[model samples]
Target: MNLETFTLFNFWSSPLLATTAEAESSSLILAGVLLSLAVIYLASKAGGELCARINLPPVLGELVFGVMVGVSVLHLLMFAEAGEDGSHSLIMNLLQATSPMGSTTFSHVFEAQSEVLSVLAEIGVVVLLFEIGLESDLKELLKVGIQSTVVAVIGVITPFVLGTTGLMLLFGTPAIPAIFAGAALTATSIGITAKVLAEMQRLNTREGQIIVGAAVIDDVLGIIVLAVVAGLARDGQVVVSDVVYLVISAAAFFIGAIWIGRLLNPLFVQLVNHMRTRGQVLLSALFFALILSYISATIHLEAILGAFAAGLVLAETEKREELQRQVAPVADVLMPVFFVIVGARTDISVLNPFVPENREGLIMASFLIVVAIVGKVLTGLGVFGQPGINRLAIGVGMVPRGEVGLVFAAIGAATGALSDALNAAIIVMVILTTFLAPPLLRWAFSLSEESATTDPASLSGNISEPVLVESERLQSELVKPEIQ
Candidate 1:
């Protein structure tokens, strides 16, 4: 429908929707934002619930719903300008029949809206990483120690090699795109694995501990790889000193933040406890997270790193329970927005097998999925010397690329390092991995349990009681204290 046809709706006819006039533009933008939020929220919620019903991750449903409403499907949120023929673009239609305002005005309006959504999505990711950090115990991670480090190192290397090699061999992709593809594969989304483990009540298990620990270590390594790749993409050549600088900066940021956070958290908690206002602790925790996130961004690292560090610090405080309780609702609201936006960014046309031109993308996506899965699975083998550990389960748990992979792909696309075909391929690979991992993990865990009970001798190794006990103890410590 044209802009005029769209503006005929009583909703747009309201004076609040006027945008062509200079005086009314701000109000029009605000109204449009509110309307967009409403649509995104309702659509995301419905999609999440639908996915849950079918035993898939709610994220998959949210993403699919985003596509359904986005440019690829309904074209409800397209951001293009009107063609030379003067037909209204979707954004123009939403602007209440604003006249053909040329590229500059269209860019301004589009950017304003897109920027808001992007910021919200970024915040959602920050909250997510924060929660993961909060749930993690540094002490337990230490205990998992060398084993997890081994698994994580292998996890990163194997996927990267496989991804790069496969892309080059299968599609004869260029070096830069191959590197981006490899980098994308290296990310292991702990959120998906954590959710699956939590659901199956295996979160406190030995295997779970190793997976979580390895995933955490994996995150650190993945971020470093991302920095290097981003630098290479921008400069068109890798400078050793630049790479070294990023490594040092990222490492210092994490270690320094954690060290500083630990030292300051007690004082911060004490100050909050003495505050007369209710929820002061929660507010303080959030402020700290936001501050750290800003600092991380300022240092050219991912903001989520600082947010995660903030969470680790806060997790050590006396008010962990209260902070978690207060933060849960906020995280719940923002997290879905990230996943939906991720879906919305996806262009489904590249995945249309019926389109002859898109066949390469389809082929690349298929091979990428295989590479993503096998790469992570090999990490399970790194869990050596520990008998009775479910290696398959560990690998399967780490399978879902989830938001982490999407973040890498998004960076590549934004930097013009990845083509449309490659981006679509990465998105499809991410979606399939995210969707497939949970059920596979569930089956793996079930098999582990059955083996333990019915055919203990058939298992490769015995479950380590000491490790399991420590894991349980750590889990107990991580749990929020009950309010009286």
Candidate 2:
């Protein structure tokens, strides 16, 4: 339906109309929705099981299952019977429902699927971030210290070089675009790595500490780089003063937020502790997150960074353990929906070969994907000190580019620094990174199977122990503490 004529209830159109022909179409559409959800649910569970069977992370399975249920493979399977002849068969009927949005055969079914996917995916992201926030411990991350700095530096440098250089070579002389592309690849999604380590029982070890430290550093540095690149893309030249201020300002926000939280931590906890209902605590904490997020956005930084920082500050409070625990289940349900939506938003047909006109966009997308992967892989070398440090794990961890990358790409597209093809390419790259990491991590962790089940060798050299400690902290923070 056209945007102008659409109403929210239009989404609730009856799948089964009164006329026989229309009723069949409606029935098929309803059946299709149920089928899709059932498949996704089963696939996700199967994927998780497959991961355990193969000694890989369950998330890898989840992603693969998503893709299978996605338009890419599943839809293709559903449509396969439409070959050669304009035949009449059940397979052909199935194909109609699975076709892209414009297919006359099953437009309603496709639209409903798309809408469901979007809502779920958005919910997934929010919950994922919230859960990550819930798991974080301010005191522990602070204690991570110099190692985190070094890891962050190495992580930022490697990807910046690889991403920019690769892009510049492929698309000659628009240095600023190249820089933005590279900057987009540099941020690390610690949640993925931490989850993998937790699964492998390595989170408490020294290696886990380094990973956590490096991830925090990478995140902070990544934003600063994005800010600078964003500024350059908006204006033809790099603004030195603006860049300096952005960096300094971001640093100050983090430092200041944590400092204030430390001071207010006790009082906030005491207030929440006295509340009769637990919702009061959750509402108050969420309020803190929102205010921080708003202030950060005002300073031209991503609100998520503020939210994350706020969570860290709260991590030091006496109620830190209780607060995290209470918030976790809410996050768990919401987060998966977000991921599903991410997959649904992706219009795979946009990268079509049949549409000769859009081929340029496809080629551009292919190039960006290459740069995105290589750039992050190069960042793997950032894991220093321990010879045993899983460089592959670090590299894979840096792979997925989520909100941070999208913001940069969107800005680039909006400012005309990037053409339509290039913008699409960046988005494709982000999706690829998000999709690829879980499997890669599972494989990397599996490679060290012998070591995973063993005891820690030493503090700095031990990857397993640190991962365990981190997970435990996450559990304590997210799962409510036992009441007296």
Candidate 3:
């Protein structure tokens, strides 16, 4: 064949070759993601079962196991945001071991798989918040006498002030790092708290309601504070209009979602009730959550907030019990993924004192940990005029830093606002605070068993009959699996 004819023939063949490579690459990515999920599910179940046998929260076990298999050790499921590529993940290595793929091709697969997993993790958390919302008593939270609001306000202000001032004064740290770390302290992980409360059958308790409500409110405030600090870090000064916009938008979105959802609930019920299709209630609720979640994300708020608002709105309807039943199985599948991811992303090697560079971060961490704990613990004192309430329980309930703190730390690191030492300190603080809160909460309530254990038959008026019934249902459901 002549040169022109030969070149055209090769060009036609090249497209087919490229298509085959693309399909193969896609398959590799899918395989990596599947293997990563297998690791996550296995780790979560094994950890959860062990914890259940040992009287600890199953989520904590999931977290611990996640840490073990994560960057700190097994390196099976680390994230790309943490600056690791395919070589860092054992899962990728295993896939390569099996398939004998080229290094470049496998690296691409690992990165793409990580991105997919990250998105799945985000959806998992959204499902978790939605589930918590379904279980919470929005009416009770409203009538809980403003304690949640007060605690949330105090929870934010106290930690920000204490952590910032303490970091600056004690360690002589610079303003940006100090402020970032301080803002990090304001985070209260509702995901972790809600899981513990549900496990303890305390979701309907006064303290549990107060903690859940405060955590939700704190989540809104945390986003605002993160924005403000992020602005101040990037620019020399905070933009008043920007902060005002965030505050106004957050308030409006949350309130507006609930109000509008209530107006639409009758129509929602009718639509679902009329559907003869399977998964009617579950799918409808998820659709509502995802739409609100999208709106919330567009407004620069957390998608979890919208999912929560969706849950709160639906919880007020007659179909709540049915919805809860349908959502439970789905939750059982997705919720552990969130917990596992949070744990997996955590790098505990920062806390190791044997390293010379870690000494400075360790000292700084000691200070931040104290501030993180004390600042949140002081939120209990804000429980004004309520006699016989376990203020310690209320305060301790807000202590865990969890994923929210990690977000602040990650942002600060990304913006170059936090130094290596400060970032390490923040990581350590998040890790320890998350580890302590569940046990501390259990202990705080344990001291005053008079309210529980003995079971006062007349906890009426303040707690609605529906709440009590829900609480009893949760307790019973803990032991027995429902049969179809």
Best by lDDT: 3
Better of 1 and 3 by lDDT: 3
Residue ranges of candidate 2 with Cα displaced over 4 Å: 1-127, 170-173, 190-205, 350-371, 386-388, 451-484
Sort the predicted structures by lDDT, highest score first: 3, 1, 2
Model 3 Cα lDDT, one tens digit per residue, 1-484: 9999999999999999889888998988898888888899999999999988987778888999988888888999978777887687888878787877886787678779989988988898899889889998888978773989999999999989998998889889898889989999999999898889988888888888899899989998999999989988888688899889989999999999999999999999999989999999889999999999999999998999999899999999999999999988888888878888888999988888999999999999998899889999999998877777889988888999898999999999988899999999999999999988877887888876866545555455446888888999998887576631
Error of 2 at 315 (Å): 3.1
Indicate the residue-level lDDT of 401 in model 1: 88
User: How well does each candidate superpose onto the true structure, as a TM-score?
Assistant: 0.79, 0.67, 0.92
TM value for model 1: 0.79
- Residue 294 lDDT (model 2): 77
- The list of candidate 3 runs beyond 4 A from truth reads 450-484
Q: Could you tell me the lDDT of residue 85 within candidate 3?
A: 73
lDDT values of the candidates?
Answer: 0.77, 0.63, 0.89
Which digits, one per residue and each the tens of the lDDT, describe model 1 over residues 1-484?
Answer: 8877887875666655454354455555565566667767876889889978887656667777877776577655443321112122254466756544545555555656666767787898888778766766666656777888898899999989998988888688899989998999999887667655754667657788789878877887887789789888998877787667767887788789989999998799779978998778777888999999999889777787788788878888878777778888888888777767666665667667998867777788998899899999989999878788999999988888877897898899989999878888898898788778877887787797786778856442455666788899988877756521
Candidate 1: where is the Cα deviation over 4 Å? 1-23, 77-107, 190-209, 230-236, 402-424, 452-484
Model 1's C-alpha root-mean-square deviation from the true structure amounts to 10.5
Ranking by TM-score: 3, 1, 2
lDDT of 1 at 390: 92
- Tell me which of candidates 2 and 3 scores higher on lDDT: 3
